[model samples]
Target: MLVYLRLLKESLSFAINALRNNKLRTLLSLLGVTIGIFSIIAVLAAVDSLDRKISKDLSSLDKNTIYLMKYCFGPSEIPQWKREQFPNVKYDEYISLKNSLTNTDQVAYQFFVNKETIKYDSKTVSDVNIVPASNEIVEIEGLNVDNGRFYTESESNSGTAVIVLGYDIAEGLFGGSEPVGKSIRLYGQRFTVIGVIAKQGAGFFGDSNDTSVYIPTNFLRRMYGDNDAMTPVIVLKPVKGVDMDAYKAQVAQKLRAIRGMKAGEMDNFFINVLSGFTDFIDGILGQMNVVGWVISGFSLLVGGFGIANIMFVSVKERTNLIGIQKSLGAKNRFILFQFLFEAVILSVIGGIIGLLLVWGISLALTQLLDFEFVLSLGNILLGTGISAIIGLISGILPAISAANLDPVEAIRTGM
Candidate 1:
């Protein structure tokens, strides 16, 4: 063991000397490994960050949650014209589903509205997301009130002029002062701020509640009647441990009955499950992972070749030293181990620099954008392990040739 340690120390010293003496050649040889590590690790970190964000954004909502609406969340067999002809889901339908559907939890009516400006006295915010949803949305969407309270059933039914401000919205409109009970102007009407939502940094689709305000859907309907610009949706959260297929069938049947659709006519609305959307995103991410592997595999292959070539050159240059060492009673295994350790050490140095580059970029990106980028310890270990493997594989043949060289022949060839 002590002998192996001495060999390792000597190998490390040789690697450092090689790097210092042949700066350009060493860096050029390391470039492929560096780029390969950077490529693989960067892709992994990005995908991981995106996956984490998705989990965070959807954590409150059940994966089994369904949206009953005219619009499809993904591609549909139904043509665009037919979809456009399908009437927007009515509030009555939402009510019917809430009452009639089995294996259900909370049902909510939501309005998809255009960007609107909101005002609190002189302070104003534009292009803000206006979430006009039924009071039950609080339960269905798992919304938490940071201050005051979410709208009550009575307030929703009566279309009371109350609003819940998102965290950043409150900060923008009221600064340090409390926003609850304060009046805000939107849609040419005054709404008393009744609650504030917790700071939700970003939503699943780049939408954030931070710049949003929630009001009763009834209030919006009462104010504007029916406008083409506003589309209504029924959001449903099914009970856990239920037969999902049977539950969805029952929901479709109830809605078909409500819409008076003839048998075999096909229901006009789309039943989009949240799980399917997440699965679709997962598939895309999987493809990205595969692509990253393919692209980086080539780079790593090139890097391996580079290391092999460098090792061959190193063996050639050290033939005289090897001959001397063998003449002085050094074993073939020691010579082989020395070359192998030097190759691995050199490759690992390149990987470390690549990892440092990734870490720096991740830090910069997280600071510059709302999204957070992460480089986990597991990935760091993976990079280092991969580098070591590349070096070992690349150096094996050259090290064997060095080990097998006849001391007399090697010394004469060097001379």
Candidate 2:
């Protein structure tokens, strides 16, 4: 073991000397590897960060939750015109489903309404998201209340003039003062602030919980009377361990009977399952990863050739030293290991530089952009493993060639 360690130390010394002696050749060789590592790792890190952000944004809601609406989230057989012609999900259907739907944890009705301006005294905040939803949305969405409480079912059923403020909206209107129990004007009417939601950072989309205000769905219904612009949707959160296929089928059958659709006729509404949407997104991200690998693989291929070329040149330059070592009882394996060590050292150096670049860029992007960029330990290990593999593959042929050289012939050629 001690003898092997001494051999390894010598091989390392030779590897460093080769790199130091050939500055221009070493830089050119390292460039290809560095670029390859950078391209691959950067793409992977970016995609991973995006995926994490998506997961974080959606963490509160159940993936099995279903949205009953006129439109579908994924590709559908139904045409655009047919989807458009389909009637909007009604408040009555939401009520019916809530009471009658089996294997359901909770159900909610929400309106996709236009942005509204909120006013408290002289302070005015515009382009605020107006989420008029049923009280059950609190549980369905797993909303966290920092102050006061969410509106009760009675207030929602009665269409009371009560509102829940988002973190930013509350901060903007009241500043240091308490926002709960205060009256705010929205849609030219005063609403009592019932609760304030906990602070949530930026969402995957521009619209965040921090910039939204929740009101009772019935309040908007009494005023607008099922306006198409409001686009009512029924959200269903199924109980855990329920058979999703049967549950969705049961829902379709019930809705079909309610709408009085004839036999063999297709259901007008779409059942947009959250799990299906996430699966579709996962497919897209997987394709992106494949593309990144293919593109970066070309750079790595070039880098491998560069490393092989440098290794072969190093072997030729050290022919005299190799012959002397062999004459002094050095083994063929030592000659092979020497070149392999050099190749690996160069590749690893390039990879380390690439990793450093990625780390610096990740920090800058996280600070500058709204989205956070993470370089995970798994990815770092993956990058390092990839680098070392590239080294072994590139060094093998040259290492073998060095090992097989005739000591006397090599010494004469070098002289």
Candidate 3:
């Protein structure tokens, strides 16, 4: 054990001395390693940050809730006429479906109409997202009111011209003044503000929840003067104490009945739970990960070759020294180990610098570019491991050449 430790210490000392002796060559070799490791770490940090943002955004939707829509989230290949076939599902249909479902505690239906500029006096806000939703949206969607209150079921049934403002919208229109009970004009019609939603921040796609406005579905329909049923996106939550799986089955059965679909026939409406959406997103990220590694692996391979060439040059320059060491009774294995140790040291230092660079870039992105930064243990390990492997392999040929040198001939030629 002591002999092994001594050998390791000697190898490190020798490697250090060699690095110090060849200042320019060492810098250039380390630069290659730095570039390779920088690529890996930068890619990994970006992927980690992207994954985190995506997971956070997806998780924003309720786990037990399902979306009832006319189209699938995975693809845009749905026939255009299919949406026309439904036109709009009636509000009465929602009550009928809710009554039929014994396992569901709450169900909310929502849809959006074409956006119109909201005007308050001379101030105008055009970037507002307007959603028409049922009263159950307050419960099923886990909404919190920042001021006033959400519109009542009675109000929705009567098609009351009431609006609920999101935090950003409220601030933009009211300028920190109380907006509840005030009037705002949308689509040439005046609507009274009843509530302001708490801030929900931004999703991964940069969609801001606070920039939205909500109102009764009936009010939205009335604004269009269309009794035609709009395709409602229904969100349902299971009753407390009911087993989720059983509730899902019961809800499915009830929805099929309401849609008047016979058994074995596909239902017209789509139901999307957490699993399908998460799986779809994960599959995309998985493909990205594979592609990123394949590209970065090529960069690492090229960098390894650069290190090998530099080491070869170094070995040739130190031929006389190697011969002297051999003449002083150094073993072939000792000479090989010294060169290998130097290569590993160089690679590791470059890797550390690369990691630091990545961290700096991540900080800059978060502070200046509004991107989230994430660092993971897995990525760190991957970068370090790849760098070490590059060093070991790159050192092989040079190490072997140094080990196999003819000491007498080397001394005679001063090589």
Candidate 4:
């Protein structure tokens, strides 16, 4: 064991000396490996940032609340025929679904208005989002009111035209003045501000909560011209002791019947459980992992080719040197191990530099994107392992040639 360690130490020292002697050649050979690793690491950093932000955004919703939408994320668009079927979940349907769920804790529907603007006296603010949803939206969204209360069902049904401002919007509209019960003009319609939502930190894309305005779903519909067929979103919460999977299945059956879906007709509505959303995010990351590996592996291959070419040149230059080593009674295995160790050392150095660069890029991205930087220890290990393997394989032919050189002939001919 001690002998093995000593040999390893000597091999490493020799490899380092060789690299130092030919700095330009060593760096030129390392370029392919560096480029390959850089590509993969950049991708990893970007994907990591995006994943963390999306996860946080999705997690903001109550775990018990299921999101009912027309389509899931990604490229799939909801079919027009399917969207037409649900038009709007009427007051009656909402009540019926809520009543039918024995384990339901809360149920709410959303009405979104994009043209919503808030005006205080002469100053007007755009980028105001208005969501007219049931009071249950507060509970489902884990919203905390800075002051005042979320409007009740009765207030919503009454179409009181009262508005709740997100933190930023409240400040913009009323400044230091108490905003509650104060009137603000929205799309030429006057609304009494009733509450302010507590500040929610920047979302996945660094968007602040202060830009939102809330009103009753009924009020939003009345003010913006309700399309009876417009159901923006449905939030459902299941009670304790109820099986979520079974309950979700039951809920789907009821919704299909309400929407008049036929058997095996492929229901158009989408049900988004928290777990399912998490899985979707993981799936996207998994694909990115594949891409990173393939691209990095290709780069490693090119680097290995560079090493093999270099080793071939070294073998030709040192033909007489190999012959001298053989004449001194060195074994073929020793010569082979020497070249292989040299190749591995070069690859390892390149990999270390590449990893450091990746880490630096990750830190920069985290600051710029305001998202998490996830560095996978597994990926680093995998990259290093592959690079070492490339070194060993690329050295094989050159090592064999070095080991088999004829001492008398090589020394005499200087070839």
Instruction: Please give the CA lDDT of all the candidate structures.
Output: 0.90, 0.90, 0.77, 0.75
- Full ranking by lDDT: 1, 2, 3, 4
> Residue 26 in model 1: shift from native, Å?
0.2
Name model 4 segments beyond 4 Å from true.
Answer: 1-24, 62-64, 69-86, 121-124, 145-149, 152-154, 157-162, 167-183, 190-200, 205-210, 228-231, 240-245, 256-278, 319-333, 376-378, 400-415
Query: Best candidate, TM-score-wise?
Result: 1
Please give the TM-score that candidate 4 achieves against the real structure: 0.79
lDDT of 2: 0.90
Worst 10 residues of 2 by lDDT: 3-12
Candidate 2 residue 103 C-alpha distance from true site, Å: 1.4
Tens-digit lDDT track of model 2 for 141-199: 99999999999999999889999999999999999999999999999889999999999
Model 1, 221-334: lDDT tens digits are: 898875678989899998999888898899899999998999999788989999999999999999998999899999989998988888999999989989999999999999
Superposed Cα deviation of residue 28, candidate 1 (Å)? 0.1
Q: What TM-score number comes out for model 3?
A: 0.85
C-alpha lDDT of candidate 3 relative to the true structure: 0.77
Estimate the TM-score of every prediction: 0.98, 0.97, 0.85, 0.79
How many pairs collide in each candidate, listed in order?
A: 0, 0, 3, 5
The residue ranges of model 2 lying beyond 4 angstroms of the native Cα positions read none
Task: Give the clashing residue pairs of candidate 1, or none.
Answer: none
What's the lDDT for candidate 1?
0.90
Model 3 segments beyond 4 Å from truth?
1-32, 76-88, 225-231, 239-249, 413-415
Which run of 10 residues does model 1 get worst, by summed lDDT? Answer: 202-211
- Which candidate ranks first by lDDT, i.e. highest? 1
Residue by residue across 273-382, what tens digits does model 3's lDDT show?
Answer: 76677777778877777777777777677778877887798788778888998999989998888888777766777777778788888888898867778767877887
Select the stronger candidate by TM-score from 1 and 3: 1
How well does candidate 3 match the true structure, expressed as C-alpha RMSD? 3.5
